[model samples]
Target: MSHRALEVLIVTGPLGAGKTTAVNRLLKAEVAAGRRVAVLINEFGAVSVDGALVDAERPELAGVENLVNGCVCCSLRDDVVATLKAWCDQPEGQRPERVVLETTGLADPTDLVDLEQEPELAGRLRLAGLLTVVSCLGPVDHLRTRPLLRRQVALASLLHLSKGDVDPSAAVAWEGDLRSAFRHIPLVLTRNGVAPTDSPDPWRGDLRPVPEGWEATAGPSFAAARSFTTAWDHPVDPAALEALLLAPPAHGELLRAKGVCAFAGWAARNDGSDRWAFQLADGRLEISPLPLRADGSAPSCAAVVIGTELDAAHWKRALRALEVPPAGARRKVTVRP
Candidate 1:
């Protein structure tokens, strides 16, 4: 039996390093160049937001799949393999030119490299390259304590230095540190998630081989972190939502938080728009209005907060406060947390 070959690229990095942003940029470039591409987004939280963001931003590109609630490098490895096999089984004309898998920030992508060597997928799937996005704004201490971060850098074919525009002075020092530590890997300084034209294209190269006897280093268990999602059916107040993300629960340090919220009277606008997206990563908060869904339906108002040792009760109560009717409102609305 024979199978059509599929190029696979893995995008990975630490939490808030902008892996999805890089993937989005690549997808736009590929689509503009008339190349058919597929994207597999693995998110740590149950309520996924990255997939929606990609869909809104890259509506022209099809084949976007979301794997949420688990890490693909471990518990969901089998599912990941199955998804790849299914893609390979597709008819030749319908197949994508390339497939990009954006792993959760906590994942160690070394395990997925073995997919090329899988008995069922040997000829069908090819491991093209691994691109790791590193945030220049992250504290230097993370290099010492976060073994997963080290593993991401050590196993990458290319390193993307993200968020350098946030702090140019600090980025200079960070780049110096990274060059001293991992000088072998090719590095690209990117701004606004845009990679240079000369950046290597994984699809154009020969497939890379899986490393033999690969082992992951010990790090804080991803299971030790917890996530809480609050979903509401009706529209929410925009200011209340922004305030919530601005000062997340004090009990735990927020690693990442993102949401697609349905709002009414958002930003004092009367344009009749209903949805907005907000993301909090590495202590920066970004909130922007979402493009209206093509289907003419509003997405549920929801937010997922991920962190270490969060106080669930307090967080839930804080979220419920968004339910109360502000002064001059006709009626109090019901909220679910």
Candidate 2:
């Protein structure tokens, strides 16, 4: 029997980092190379928007599993293992050549390493590498405040930093700080969602919220930054949506925002298929044409925005300016940062 151990790679990053884009580009390239690959997406949100974006792009995957509504590092560890077991149980002809597990931005990368220590998985799967992405556009305090960032950096086989070209000087400082914080992780700056040695294709866009009338969850040191996720049923205007992202009210309070939005009418591209993916960060806005969807796939319209002094009222008014579909404004739920 010519049996091969399944290689498992873990990808982790902060909330706004470009992990999705990097993973997406890598998947496309691997598939193009005629490799059977599977992806396990762990999203920390009530709605699984990240999984949706990934599902649309690569339908021919060996298998795709999404563990949502909790971080896989803690609450969903069993679920993740179950997914791996199911994949391993597949017939030899059906098993994939490689398996990639993309963890929630808030996940502890070390936890995944711990999972590989399990006796059951040792024979079937091998932990290949760890890829940690860092977005330069996020507030500095946010990075410093995150609890597990140091561990993530220390464990990363490859450290990828994105959007550094936006500010060369800041990138230098960020790299220095990262080196000072972590032991000895090889760091690489990513261009257009990939490293210099890699050729590319491009790009894409969780968390539960705290609940209403409850004391606000104590946040990290990022008092100047906040993030919110929205899922709307109605269509949005592309131009209006762009303007809102590019020039949000309150004088540059918007730091970075990304989402999969739907639009109607003649200009609207949601002809029962196709998605409009929008990204805004570090004073830049981009609109990319997403692929037409697989059969019976529903339209995905969601957005996550990070900004200074951003609150529900502000976000609500901002989307309203673009006449966006209502994104469930009745609750005041937030996740512990």
Candidate 3:
């Protein structure tokens, strides 16, 4: 860290907590103010779907970039360091005033905040804040207060609750649980990533409540959760696929699921179509329409699944039950510690 001037807001949250949506909203505000802000989005899967999902009224965000195939907490740390270095090296007038780094759902914000301590960015990149999104529609298993989720919630300066409209009672329970677990962190209600109209200044402060005996250098708490990537040969049926996602595998607790699926002719649309980007976090399923990749070609991925104490046999059995399949073998994506 060298004489830092660029402020970075690390937006994070548990799986399906709506981290992407929040970042997009933040970006719109920053851009509206005519401030120079760059958004770096990270995804755990080899194939990235989130970059496109960040789209809003702008169709494509102006200063957004994707860091996929690795979570910044672990494998893609170098990519982050390099990108920031490049930005700082730019002409003073050309550098962005702020950077919004949206970590993968499985990421640990500490891993990123600690980067400010490194010599390279020690004084150059400042931690603006860490914002975490937690939604009411999450899976029953995530409600158990897993260490990974707790760690995410604990490190936030601001907490954004998504899907509160779906279940008011569940939202209250979630807010209560988080309030009981962490102090001083403010919770904001959000829908489709829009920040609450009443939210106070987001950059007010930062909080680090690392539990005793927890080493800052220690790897993220996802050790209990296993993640893998699986692909099929062709497109899938949306209705049938949602059915399987709602009923997860019998083997383990599904914490997150996402994929770029082909729905070439599943339905008719006067408007053109690409693939349907699907994500399951906590247990809520969100599906969106995705355009082609940068090369003008569709993405080459089917799906990615992650869960705690994964039972491979049972997981594969569930995949076999998909309404449309028999296209190819399933390959698991590994997250190196």
**Top lDDT model:** 1
Candidate 1 worst ten-residue window by lDDT: 202-211
Query: Each candidate: what lDDT?
Result: 0.76, 0.67, 0.71
Q: Report the lDDT tens digits of candidate 1 across residue range 186-253.
A: 78889989878897764443324445554555554466667778775555666786787778567877
> Could you tell me how far off, in angstroms, the CA of residue 333 lies in candidate 3 after the best superposition?
17
For model 2, what is the error of residue 22's alpha carbon versus the real structure, in angstroms, after optimal superposition? 0.9
Could you tally the backbone clashes for each prediction?
0, 8, 13
Candidate rank order under TM-score = 1, 3, 2
Error of 2 at 38 (Å): 0.6
Off by over 4 Å in 2: 139-145, 198-230, 237-258, 264-266, 269-274, 279-286, 296-298, 303-337
Report residue 319 deviation for candidate 1 (angstroms).
1.8
Question: What RMSD, rounded to one decimal, does every model reach?
Answer: 3.1, 8.2, 4.8
Clash pairs for candidate 2: 44-207, 45-207, 209-333, 209-334, 209-335, 210-333, 210-334, 210-335
On residues 1-337, what C-alpha lDDT tens digit does candidate 2 reach at each position? Answer: 6457777878888765778788887787778988888999987645565676687675478888888667777779889888887887788979987877898766666557765567667678877777888877765555566555555565677788888877776677777787777645567788767787652222111111212333223443133345677765566777778777766466436655777766644253555454677767556677666655566665566777655566656675556445443456432333232
Q: How far in Å is the alpha carbon of 246 misplaced in model 3?
A: 2.2
Minimal lDDT window, size 10, model 3? 328-337
In candidate 1 the C-alpha lDDT for residue 151 amounts to 74
Candidate 3: stretches off by over 4 Å = 1-4, 55-63, 139-144, 208-211, 215-220, 292-301, 311-337
